[model samples]
Target: MPLFFLSYSHVPVHRAGRSPDFDRLVFRFFEDLCGHLAAAGGPEGNAAGFVERPGTPAEETLRALADCRVFVPLYAKRYFTDPKCGRHWTAATTGPADTRPAVVPVLWTPYPPAALPRAAQYDLPAMPGDGDEAEEEYAATGLHQMLQLGEELGDGRAGRITAWLARRVLYAAATVPAPPGDRHVPGPLTALDNAFTAPLPAPPTLRITVLAPTEEQLPIGRDESRYGPAAEDWRPYGPALGPLADQVRALARNLGFTPDLVAFDKPRAELRGTAVPDAPWVLVVDPWALENPRVADQVREFDAVRRPWTAVLSVLPEDDPQTKERSERLTRLLHTCFPRFLREGRAGEQNAVRGLPDADVFALWFSELAESARMRYLRYIHSQLSAGGDGTGDRTEGRP
Candidate 1:
């Protein structure tokens, strides 16, 4: 078995006082190391370890050191100056006559090895190259050098310590493990010592669906009724409609709706044939062939997969001289085609550059929508729980 002997800055409780917080951090580092080492060699590769000389007798401590094939020295700012550290370093690193265990030094803090007293610094590996001052130079240089020298010198310090540990500590570093299930566990190491203990990213709340033109060279319409001169010039609305759907989804999110965004782009018949997931709210922007009466069967197909409570934002071009006429025609077409919108929970909404007076108006409206949505969702959840599923009360109708 690959045995690791861990040594760190030690503060005896009677000598100093209570255990400093740094001790916890050092333990966490070793814990993580164990995990990494196990992953590299498999369960059989993992071996028992100790941080300090743990036995009552000096002989017992010596025996533990004898069994240790790898000695991991952890360093920090105080490590160099502490007297106990000096003794521990001598015991761990000083070879007995000719035989010695490989010594791997890991610097937890950024202080330079040069800062260590001459007696303590001697016999260590050469110092790494200098780096930026803003960065903790010693830690970065030392760590990179350590990783480069992996498994060869029998000197414990080399080769991908962080990466190796990552795989070992969290089984299969290929995927991030899900967080703890119940009550939160206090980290073995605090933030001052370890980065791995921080909280993971929250899962995404909104899904975005991006819609773009299906074909590049579809001819401009010949009939004036199809669209005016601008409509004929409307090469493809998809490119212009990129961030607009995000803005609409932001509005929906603020209104207490969960959004799942999907992207559809041009020249792909797959987009035209695809189905949108059933959501409480959906925003379809610049649906490329959606307005063509010939594609009514294709357009209304969204209703087949969606729920009754869906709010659909159907985006079409207002790119003609008669903007109002185009909008009115589009609205009527949506009403006729998507019969789902005529129901109680479903509604048709539209957005255009014209609706926003300026950036200020847009910002204010967006903020208001988000606030209202959160408040509405909160009230709905509260009501659902309180009314025994009847939803009987007015639900925060008049409250200040």
Candidate 2:
């Protein structure tokens, strides 16, 4: 069962236009919230503990609420007005008097306690809204004082909020008793404010050079193959590099890194110019595409460099005998290039590679890769900080 269910209205009532600013803020909040919770051994500390998103089936939402130990309602004026949001609140609190889930109301938007539903009126911690007054209040607290140090070191509001929300969720998760009749109550939760108090680790500035064939290079005109007859259809049925690159970009944003994507055919000087010379580079290789002499030369040039580089070999699905043969050929080609490459597939399966057909499984594999890359980058940053040197460590050859 999940430790808590996060409930919020995705659309705002008063806002006329869909503001990108608001969207970014919310996205960063959840990312940091879950990241911190996972670090603190909360339900979100693992892959299973996921925040419920919009468009979830009503039955599914109810089932999740029934199993969750806490219901966290992100209260805004718009939240109470939405029927779906109201139903979510009702479903969590509506059962038998003793069995209702515990409510942890988060005042995401500043509204009086009277504005909330009668069932949600219990005293709870409220996060400050984005206002000067709230900022002033936060600035007075020890948490804010510690965060000031991070800000001085270049951490922004988003970093501060991540640390703040993580600490808040940790405290809430630790102190709140489990829902009634829960057989397995979690052990005592300890306060780890010190973790937040420390200077926030800056995300390493890295560039991910995606070495793969473009749509024009791939055989999209052939109807017999899975690449499809149309160029646009290639995204879903063709090689996994494009989609995988997109997934990596999305995950990298959540990890606080803005990675630039460089294609295989892009000039080496342009690639060298854009890439951060000191940061780690993730080379996403499309094995079949590497059959091209120019592409092969690019890979060898990148490998020749002595810097830290991660190679991800993209392969086709091995669902049939013919497909299996093709996938094996690609895997062999990958081995000849890197000798060691991470296969994207089910964990612990030897020589398992990602297949475009199983989008869900491949997505999970990419998410894990992005997370591992983030950790590696974080370690690199920490080492630089510990050495009392500026964040830029040693420079590596960026040409490839």
Candidate 3:
């Protein structure tokens, strides 16, 4: 078993529009911390600490958390709210409070002291010198932010602080040695409450509608390779992406949106005349669907209409051979069909509704789509409220 289990929340998606470096820095911090721990532990520290990654066996995590000598938690806003992190913490600190395993809290991000939960706070030893300026600064900046501002992993406060943390973990292993614990936590880890609080309000909704044909409905010569039972299962991106609807749902969840998947068979009346939606909507469109007169009319009607809260995304996978051969033809068809989408004057950024080449591009574009819909909705509602009317803004007459 490893000497320490590095417990932290997993960030699932690369947030849209932010520099990718934020997540890179986070991973680099973890690697550096592990390296520091190993160096401090000497020849015996080959596997000085363990951090879980995707595809790591659950049993391995169960054993490491149960058996490790020290519990090193990486604290951040995400860390507190993640139920998985809570389970790990609960499993590691399984016994009586006084005799619980040694814990070394690694601050990755700062949280207001009062906003902290009992799980992290209760474990902290009540040491004096509470008003110290250096401590306050350290508390405020967090180890991760310090790292972001050119703090090297091996020198200065960042280095020294990490080095001190490593030594403490090593010392805990020596003085309070613990053997590999049984794999079983007292109960199911899933039942454990999250240690830190996630915001209480219901998350905003992102409605996703997949418009495509089922295998049986494909036009004469079209291959049925990627079509599943329904429109939601239309995987224009091929086998690798599975279904676009599911992918959008996962991405939506990562972005803190409650994804509501609407069927393509939804009434046209409801689609056109709705006064306002409780959530923003994204349409996952496969070019094949445009062949069906009904689907195409809906697509064109949706496109020509002035619904800022709706973002239409045309998916024609780049890697798929069938999709590649027809990509240009399909895109041109879209341009001709939906003149408003192809029209040029679309604010500062690229058009929010347009072609997405593949799943990767789809993901990137979907992030923007979600944000665009959200912002447009907010902007419209705000306009209505300021004009001394109910906040239920409708888009019966305008150009998006």
Candidate 4:
């Protein structure tokens, strides 16, 4: 049996003879992954990896999926809908979470987590890349784009990412290998239909604005490591992960909102909450942002004229002791700048954003805040219609 099964939907573009460019890239990637596996002392030659040929029977693919030590699923729009692919995914992931081989999912084409089938949505593990830019590229786009960058597979960043994936697969195989379910089970196991159905409803948009300082705008004496080329690079939570805005974006996506990261410093007509009818704005505030005179002004301006559909989430890191005094001073000053949000949370709590030191707690609060913001937008539209105005809730000329 092959060490891994490369489970993917057979499309004409990815077919061996139909599209030369796609076939070349895919085959090269597969061969390179196999070579990496072999170099790591894994199976070699014909027993290294298995990919079903075009027109292969579903039973053949299912048998390979059942025997592999690891399952590498290339996720795409068509992969979920293909009957054979669905069958493989369902059978491989049916037993207890620990009973199946670890799945290393690749986002061949961009699709929301919500778009995945129920089993896949809960079972797929995250594939973090080697570096920040690389991880962002893989997350924003997919590995298919990386293949186009270099003529040959296993070249440059694409190669590095592939190697990283190969090592992760090998690591999991040795440490957490689980016996796959028997493929010869009777009854519905052999005749089960596709596990997925029609696509789910599109998630609503959340315009995630990051109100933080760029490296150039950072106050003197500040740690430059935390600040990067742009505001989106600000990681208030520390140096462990990506920017706080992106962490929030991932959390937003998990909660069923399509998150859009926007630069708060950029001037746009969409800053007016009513301008974006479908997407509510959520400002992710960095505590040190108040130190800069210009950012402070922007914060006050937003608080003064911001609409109900706009919400603020302030992230204060408890681990950064140096920032504690300065953060408290800013919080006290922030209350005067915006009296409503600062007082509405818990009795002793100055703001809802406080006391959230991690993503789990942040997500719990963000869900309610995002929904509340959406409802406010709907209420505004309803009142406008009830008052015989356009449902857009805005009539003033050039208000933005």
Best by TM-score: 4
Residues 77-152 of candidate 3: C-alpha lDDT, one tens digit per residue:
7877777987887787665433345666666786432234655542331111233433444555777766655454
The 10-residue segment with the lowest total lDDT in model 1:
391-400
Ranking by lDDT: 4, 3, 2, 1
lDDT of each: 0.40, 0.48, 0.64, 0.65
Clashing residue pairs in candidate 3 are none
Question: What TM-score fits each model?
Answer: 0.30, 0.37, 0.47, 0.51
TM-score for candidate 2, please give it. Answer: 0.37
Give the Cα error of residue 379 in candidate 2, in Å: 2.9
Clashing pairs in 2: 38-45
lDDT tens digits, residue span 100-214, model 1: 3444455555443223444433223222222223122333454433433333445344334443433322232112112112212222211112221234333224333433333
Candidate 2 Cα errors over 4 Å, as ranges: 1-206, 219-245, 251-259, 265-280, 304-313, 318-325, 342-357, 381-400
Which one wins by TM-score: 2 or 3?
A: 3
Q: On TM-score, who's better, 2 or 4?
A: 4
Q: What is the lDDT of residue 342 in candidate 2?
A: 32
Higher-ranked by lDDT: 1 or 2? 2
Q: Write the per-residue lDDT of candidate 2 for residues 125-214, one digit (tens) a residue.
A: 334434443343442342323344544766455455555555555454444345554432221112111111233345444466555555
- Residue pairs that clash (backbone atoms under 3 angstroms), model 4: none
